[model samples]
Target: MVAVTDKSILGCRYGSSQPQRDTVLYADLYREGRLLLDELVTETYPVEDFAKAADDAHHGRVARGVLVF
Candidate 1:
């Protein structure tokens, strides 16, 4: 993987700069790096478990967690 540059950090990543506070962008699902995981997903949790997921994320136990109905 390549290191992110200042320009990339400003452009590709959002909400990092104070000047961008007023800029609004509408992104398409696919265009926003959204992907279809389908059955490839490994874990899921109920919405009530969000606190547990938040703790896991804070502790670096997982990269991400999903809450579902």
Candidate 2:
């Protein structure tokens, strides 16, 4: 399994700058990285949808997956 640190992931998500926030740069990086994953999946799940998936996974209510990047 690939272990991604929170700091690195957050940096990818929010960028390392203040103004402009480098959003586009980070987004490009994320797309490239995610493309290397086993699955070529992309979806925008709302909070409720995520929570339900987590519940099903564990048979209990739990916070859904949080992708800092």
Off by over 4 Å in 1: 1-42
- After superposition on all C-alphas, the RMSD of every candidate to the true structure, in Å, is 10.0, 12.6
Number of backbone collisions per candidate:
0, 0
Q: What TM-score does candidate 1 get on C-alpha atoms? A: 0.40
Clashing pairs in 1: none
The CA lDDT of each predicted structure is 0.61, 0.52
**lDDT, candidate 1, 1-69, per-residue tens:** 988676543354444544443333323443565644444444577999989878887887766577897
lDDT of 2 by residue, 6-40 (tens): 65433354345754656676677678885353243
Q: Over 4 Å off in model 2, which ranges?
A: 1-16, 19-21, 34-60, 65-69
Looking at model 1, residue 56 earns an lDDT score of 81
